[model samples]
Structure formats: structure tokens, C-alpha cells
Target: MTISSQSARDLTANITALSDKSVALMHQRSMSDEAVTTFQNILQKVQEIHDPKAALRSLSAEELDVVRQAHSLAESINISVLSDEGAANLLNAPGHTKDLNNDGLTTIGEGNMLTFPPDNAPASFKAAWEEASDGLSTMDIPTHMIFAVGLANIGREPGDLNWVNPYASPDYDYGAAVSEIIESVEYQYNHNMMSFEQYQKNMSFYNTLTEALA
Candidate 1:
């Protein structure tokens, strides 16, 4: 990441804020409280990072995974705004696509960006995508289907088909997949991201008519 002095400080503030917000949301969602508290306590080690710029990549890969896991915990449970912009300025870098998780696919960046699988994508990747995306309109819920496909394997090479299975999945188990669809459909409705008919259609995709109307 090309760093200007101003941008470096901005990124620092963003990461710090994201960390704080992430912790708060974890509590609201009644996540594994003891575990979340312990995990964040470890993040305090970052305070030893004196220089804002130095703090950018100061985290080891494992540590970085911890942070992402924390945020993704909240995200896959429902939806998350934690990745908005942070020490992860990589999303803002001009013309650069990075697989932050080193999952081999770099297209699903912050904000759940997308790029189709290469034709040569492994059989596993194709299969995971196909299963998660089955029977859904590629153009419509391709983005939303991401949750069912497994947020952890967004670009994971040799993708795991069980990415959606709770016991084997990488996402938090506090909610159901259809709950995500329900929440997103309501969010779209409240925010006017879609029309009423479209919102109904989205909800009905996974929920029964009674549930959708409810």
C-alpha cells in the first residue's frame, strides 16, 4: 500500500474505530461474549505499535485473521459495516485487487465486491459457487448468496463445499441463512434500496408467504 503521511494517519484512525465498533456490535448480537472479550484483549497488544504507519502491517497473518474473523463474525451473522474503511486502505488503492485472506480469489474485497471465477477455477470452487448460487438469479442475489456460500471462502482456493454448513462453516452460528435474507430484504426496504415488489420477491425467495408478510 502506497502510503502518504496523511493517508497513513487516516488509515490508523479507521482501523481503531473499526475495532471499537466491532466489539460493540459483538455484544449487541450476544455472540460468544467471553470469547469475544478475550479475543479483543489480545488486540490490545497493538497499542505497542507506536507509529501509525508501522501499525499498518504490524499484525502477523494469524493476527490479521483474528481481526477479520471478529468482524466477519458479526457480518455473516447478519450484515456488517465494520469493513467500511480502515487500516485496510487496500480497498481504496487505485486499480489494485488483493485477496486479503489470501484465499486465491481477490475480487471479493471490502463491501463484498465481486469478480467472476476464472474459467480454470478448481472444481471445488465451482462446486461451492454452484451450490450456494443454485436456483438463484446470478445477477440478483449473487452478492447476497455470498453468505450462504461461506464468507470465509469468498476466494478460498480449493473451496470447501461445506462452507455453508454451521458445524463446518466459517461463519457465526447465531442466525440462520434465511435470517440473513430476511434482514437484508428489510434493510433494502427501509433504505429504499429496492422496490416493494422487489423486496417481497427477495423475502419470498427463502421465506414462505406467511413469513414474508409477517
Candidate 2:
């Protein structure tokens, strides 16, 4: 489930936008009915996936076991993207191997400009890009998977694995491990481990996910 450099940047940008929106929503003391409903739905989805206590009990035994394992692995990561203390580490995350413009286009980097062309990205690269984007966009994934994928995107490129983790210089494949956990969540979803209501809750579970991880 490792992500390519381009995918990593794109996912990070998307998550950042979501986080920004969450923050904005939090500042409003009185929100419109629609806004309140949206907020509640998001929060419920997040709780469903990230909260063990609130997990859907409808899943098969095997699915539940796998979900537990993935949840445990997700819980072990200590990096908190929300805290000021942890923010520096996040900001210093390694750059992508390829060039990513603020406008969401991926490219190849040179001295001052980026080169954009179909040939610049091979079929494999394009396929991986599509897969990562599609997987992340799905409502079936948990918040842990989202963070894991983002981390994977940090170093999933062909040669970028060498520079993946700043904290642990070598020997660890955090991205791969996290991606597996994400896949496990998907497996649980496919297996009906949780009800649609519970699966739906994880969409807004970022706050709960952050809190649980904290």
C-alpha cells in the first residue's frame, strides 16, 4: 500500500484542506442546521472507525480480529499532526521525488521549472497514482489509514524509500506497515464487519482518531 511521491503530496494537500475545514467549523459557536448536520455526520464516521468501543459488532470474527490488529498498529504511531510540538516534524516531512505544483498537477523537476508530459510518468506510475487517489477518496477507509497512506506517500516512489522517514533514518518501512493496516480496514468493510452506519461514521473520525492516537 505504499504510495508514490506524487500521491503523497496530493494526499497531504487533500488532508490539509480537510483539516483546515474542520478547524474553521470548530470556531463557529452557532452553525447553520446543514453545517451542524455535516459536522455530526463527519464526527460519527470518524468515531466508528477509530474508536474501538464504538466499533460495529456486525463484522465476522476474522474481520473483527484483523480490524483490531490494524487498530493496534495505528495506535502505536506517536506523531501527532495537530499539536504545535508535532507540527514542526510534519512541516519538515521529506519532499516528493517528483515535482508537485500547488495547483495539484504532478511533474518532473528541473533547475527552476517542472516538466509535464505523459511520457514523464510511466504506466506503472500512472496506475499507482490512480490507485492511491481512488483508495484515499473512498469512504470505507479509516482515519488511521489516511494518516498511514499520507506517510507512505512520503516515500513510496521508486527511489524515494531511501529518504522516507526523518525520525528513523533506516531499516523501518512505516509506510508499508501502515498501508497494510489501511487495507485491513478495507477488508473489514468488504466483509461487513461494521454496519453501513458505523462505516459511515469514520468519515468524520479524524478528531476522534487524533484524540485516540494522542
Candidate 3:
């Protein structure tokens, strides 16, 4: 029902450190600006930790079963996947006009529910799954089922459909959240907004400095 705490100290450290950067990103504005490239790096890290088969493997049996159920639900719908070109172009489009800094950060315990187009739901889920697959079949059912779903969703709605660990909640729509991160980074990368030297560096102060903090 919970993420594998194989090394509670390391996992806590990673999550605690990553959480601040995630919050800083939540309020960053100016999708047109070069900071967006940093946003891209952050997004990459999130999917890096959560999507790959290796990341999925880190999940508890119950957590993965929950994700598998979500994967199956997503597959049941006919997803109108965009071609590579279309997806590439769409990912680079402009986003919110105004920047934001609410002067407050949101912990996982708190978030606002977001809405997504029904038409795009399946594709978004598929994209998340694909990013997680890392060339392996994400749909391969494992040998056993210890529990039906994670305890986090024990009393929730029948089909909230957001089943990836930690972020799976009725309050926060992970798919929509990912679209925002993707579009910002894609815009900067596609437009050559950051210099090669700068682009190659991890510019997010929060992430880079966290090790020092810890």
C-alpha cells in the first residue's frame, strides 16, 4: 500500500529534497522564458523516478497492482494518439500568460483537482505509461496479487483513474499536471532558448543545492 522503503533514510532524503523543487516549479511562471528549460529538467527527473520500469519496480506489490489496474482502464478506452510530429509540435506550444508565486508551497497532502479533456485522457495516460515502460511491456501482469489496491485509495471514488504512486489522488490530476511541465520544457528546448553550456547544466537552484542542504 506504500512505496518500498528499502532505505527509508535515502528515500526520505530524495523525497524531501525533490519536494521543494517540485513546489518551486509549481509556482514558476513565464513559459516563454528560458527558466522553462530548467522546468524541463525537473519534469524529466519526475518521470525519471516514476515512469521507467525500474521506477515501477520500486513500487510495492499493492501499489503496482493499482497502477496495473489503471493501465488496464486506460487501455480499454480508444486513445487517439498523436503522431510523433504532432505530439512534438503540440508539446512546444505556449502556455499560461502570467507567472505565479503564491508565496506558498503545496505538500502532497494538499492539491487542487484539475480537469482534462475526455478526448485526450487515454492518450495522456498512455504517454505516462510509455514513459514509464522504458521499452519494456508495461502491461505484463506479474505472478501474484497480494492486495487489490493501495490503502491510499481505500475509501475513494470507484474510478478516480489516477493510479501512479504518491500523486494518485482525486485532488491532483497527474496527467494534466504533466502536460503543463511537458509544454514548458518542450517550448524552451524546441526554440533553442538556453545556451548549450547553460542547457547542459542543472540550473534549478533548489535541486542542485539540496544536497548541500541535507
Q: What is the C-alpha lDDT of each candidate?
A: 0.43, 0.34, 0.30
What are the per-residue Cα lDDT tens digits for candidate 1 across 44-88? Answer: 555445343244356565545444455443332211323322334
After superposition, which runs of candidate 3 have C-alpha atoms over 4 Å from their true positions?
1-168, 193-214
TM-scores of all predicted structures: 0.28, 0.19, 0.18
Candidate 1: give the clashing pairs. none
Question: Clashing pairs in model 2?
Answer: 42-204, 44-201, 45-201, 45-202, 46-201, 46-202, 46-205, 59-193
User: Order of all candidates by lDDT, from best down to worst?
Assistant: 1, 2, 3
Indicate the worst ten consecutive residues by lDDT in candidate 3.
97-106
| Model 1 per-residue lDDT at 93 | 25
lDDT of 3 by residue, 1-214 (tens): 2223232222222321224343344334322224344434333343435222334345455443332232222222111332222111111112211001110111111111122212123454434443443344423311111122333345554224543233333344544444454455456666998565533332232122222223
Superior by TM-score: candidate 1 or candidate 2: 1
lDDT of 1: 0.43
Which pairs of residues have clashing backbones in candidate 3?
51-132
